[model samples]
Target: MTFHYTRLANGLEILGESMPQSRSVAVGFFVQTGARNERPEEAGVSHFLEHMVFKGSERRTAWDVNRDFDAIGAHYNACTGEETTLYYAAVLPEYLFAALDILTDILRPSLRPEDFDTEKQVILEEIRMYEDQPAWSAYDEAVALFFGDHPLGHRILGTVESITALTRQQMLDYYRRRYLAGNIVVAVAGRLDWEATAAWLAEHCQHWPAGATPRRVTPVVSRPARKSVHRPQVNQEHMFLLTPAPPVESELRYAAEVLATILGDDTGSRLYWALIDTGRADSADMSYHEYQGAGAFFTYLCCEPADAAANLEITLETFRTAVRQGITEEEIRQAQSKLASRLVRGNERPQGRMRSLGYTWIYQHEYRSVDEELGRLRAVKREHLSQLLEQYNLLEPTIVALGPLAELAGTVFPAS
Candidate 1:
């Protein structure tokens, strides 16, 4: 495998990783813009614009674009997050150029007024669908409670009112401002002749606009507290414990991973044994989200309304136990092995390699080989996890729940 990183004369950075043994290729466009960059009223515009990108473009009708992708058997999709919007595709190595062509054309979108109107309704429906799902709604509310009005906590899918009020002109202006060459990274992975692929991008993207780089995201103010939502629509109560944590570039990230895995790994970690194994809850797990300058540690639980408080207590107690008694040597070794093994296995395919390329460039701004990444995790000492738990106070959580929890209002779950 070999890697190439270049900055074109126009300022767009093209980053790629080539593994000749792989039969598939994945390509992605990572734009450094999303809900966090939006004005207060433009909550959903970032995601809305992502939809418009595919509705049409300068040279291809929406139908033509879809048909072409289908013709090549490309599996493609796009997503909007707190800090980035990505459009990506994976296909047989032979379809690499065709996939790249379709993706590039869409990124330079048409954003027609008619297309905007239709896509707006589709997006509204998507938001509604998510609203009806308890788990998704719970996580969104948890983020809001944790970060308050901070841009990092803003909803990726803007509220119905926000999406409804958005205008085509507003979206067009946003597209121009955030989709600048300097603010975008075109990442690809798999077997491809670097010279030919680079030349193709240079020619096809020559007309791509070069604009001022977008400003850095403002730092977030974390409001560490608890809040609850009463949703009569669901049978289970959904609860999340969110805490502020280190950003993506922090070396503590490796330790954080081990911490989460040791405490709440779904297969049979502490939480699974304390909660799921005993039937205290339906499902429980812990995860970490590392944004550019903002990050969060989350523990999510779904259970009957009657079991909500009890299960939350159990989850908190598990953390306290780990902190007070210390993570066992065997547990630390197991977590490290689990995390390192995943890192090695995940990079075997182009799709996984593609994510590594995009995320490495976007957050770390440097690339580390898979072996190097595994080594970093392996090097993390048990003391590092202990230090993070003590110094940063990960045991005291900011709680958010959605369900029939009117009785729990004005009440924060006890940490003990």
Candidate 2:
């Protein structure tokens, strides 16, 4: 395996990880802009633009884009998130250049008025679909409550009103501002020659104008509160608890991940045994999400409306015990083993390796081998978990609950 990094004169970065033994190759375009980068009026434009990119480009029609990808037997998709957007494809090594060509063309979308008008309804429907899900609504509200006015709290899909009022010209303006050459990275992995890939990108991407939009990286100030929304259509109660954690750049990130897993992994976790096994909650888990300059630690639970209070109490007690007593060595060992297995297994595939390579450079501007990552996980000790629990004050979490029960709104769970 060989790793290569090149920065073109036009300011675009190309990252490649060569795995000679692999039969397939994966390529991705990582854009350093998302919901958090948008102004109030431009809400959802990043995601909307992601859809339009596939609708057509200056050089190819939407049908041609899809048909060409299909012709090469490629698997492709795109994602928009709070901090970034990505478009990626995986195909047999022999079709690498064909896949790269299609991927590149889509990035320069025409954003035609007719296509934009038609895609608006599709975006609205997508937003409505998520709104119908109780868990999704609850989490969305929880984010709003925790971050207050912070852009990190902005909804990726934006609100119905925002999308309905958005215009094609507005999206085109956003595209021109955020999709600059310096703001994007092209990552490729698997069977490929680094020299050839670099030369190809240099020639093809030379025409892209060079510039970058500066990201606003103010420290995230969290607002802690207890909020509840009454959703009559939901048969069960959904709860999301949020607290601040270390940012993605913190050295303690690996430890934070392990602690979350030990506390709320889907199975064989503190929450799983305390709530799920006892049937007090249908789903319970904890996740730590980190962005460029801020991060959030989340604990989620869903249960029958009648069992909401009891389940919440049990979940809190479990957290309290771990915080006060610290995690046992056995628990730490188990969490590390589980996480290590997942880390190594995930990177073994070309697609996964491509994503890892892209994200690492995007966030940290560094390359970390699978062994180096595993070492970080292995180095986490009980003391590290204890430090995170103390530093974050997980006891005073901002909570959001949604269900048929209205009384939960008035109920208070004090931080002890």
Candidate 3:
């Protein structure tokens, strides 16, 4: 991999990774502001601004944004998360410039008032859709439990009240406050003339002025918390357990990933083998989320009310035992191998490469070549795993459950 970076005078950070083997080029336009940066009153503004940008830009209408890309046989989309709003595009290497243009136009959109109202309704419905899904709602509830009143506790889509109350000026104000050149990064991977690409972006964004430096997200010490919502209408109960861990840059970060994989990574992992295979859970999985300044290990299980209590107990006990008794050499090797494979496989796609590239750039603010990352993963050992267990043991965890929980009194779950 070849890497190059240039900082625009106003503060835009542009970087690119050249992969000549692939016939496609992936480009990501990332802004650092996310749900965590918003004030309680400004809950969904960052996400809303992300949507409004695509509604129309200075050079293209919303329809044109999609139509032009389709004309070029390109794949393009955007997403907003707790820490960043990423707009990405992938196309044949020959069409790299066209894709870049589309992304640039979207980032500098015209926040029309009429479009704001329309998108607000769409977003409100999106929030409602999440409210209706038990599995999805459970994760959101878990985050709230883990973070309490912190901004990270709020939903990225925010509440209906927050979205509906937002005015065009409020949205534009957020754009001005957060969408500065310094807050943005343009990253591309797989094929391209870096010099030419940099020149093209510089010419277009040269005059873009720096706005206020977005507020830095403060790291909160998350404690354990629990919430149970009994919504009888849902057929199955959703249970989420979150354990606080270290930041992305911590030494124990990779161990946290291995632990999550051992518990509930996929169909072959412990959760699925113990619960789903035994008919204790209808569906289950665990994942690790390492943020800019913090991390959380989450284990999620959805099951019938008949098995909910037993399933929850078994899962918690399993984790506690592993942390205390230590993992076997086989389990440690398997978990590490699984995680390593996932890291490699994820980079196979253009979008995945772009995501990994963009995330690594933000987390490290410098390039970590693929070979170097793999080396770190390979060096992990069982003693290191035990040390990690001692460091991030999830004895107390934040729990969120949505279902017919009349049978379950307050379980001694973790408090956030």
**Top-scoring candidate (TM-score):** 2
Clashing pairs counted in every model: 0, 0, 9
List candidate 2 segments past 4 Å from native.
409-413
Question: Which residue pairs clash in candidate 3?
Answer: 223-415, 223-416, 224-414, 224-415, 224-416, 225-414, 225-415, 225-416, 397-414
So what's the TM-score on candidate 1?
0.96
Give per-model TM-scores. Answer: 0.96, 0.98, 0.96
**lDDT tens digits, residue span 91-136, model 1:** 9989999999899888888888888889999999999999989899
Q: Write the per-residue lDDT of candidate 3 for residues 1-416, one digit (tens) a residue.
A: 68889988888888888887878889998888899887777779888888888887878888998898998898888889888889888999889998888888788889987888899999999999989888888888888878887777878998989988878887787788888888888889888899999999999887787754755667767776777888888888898888877788887787777777887877678888889888878888888888867788888889888888788888887787777787777887888788778888888776787888888887777787767777887677778778877777577877788997744543455321
Better of 1 and 2 by TM-score: 2
Best by lDDT: 2
lDDT of each: 0.85, 0.90, 0.82
lDDT of 2 by residue, 126-217 (tens): 99999999999999999999999999989999989999999988998898999999999999999998899899889889899799887979
- The regions of model 3 sitting more than 4 angstroms off are 211-215, 407-416
Give model 2's TM-score versus the native structure.
0.98
Residue 407 Cα positional deviation in candidate 3, in Å, after optimal superposition: 4.7
Better of 1 and 3 by TM-score: 1
C-alpha lDDT (0 to 100) for residue 2 of candidate 2: 86
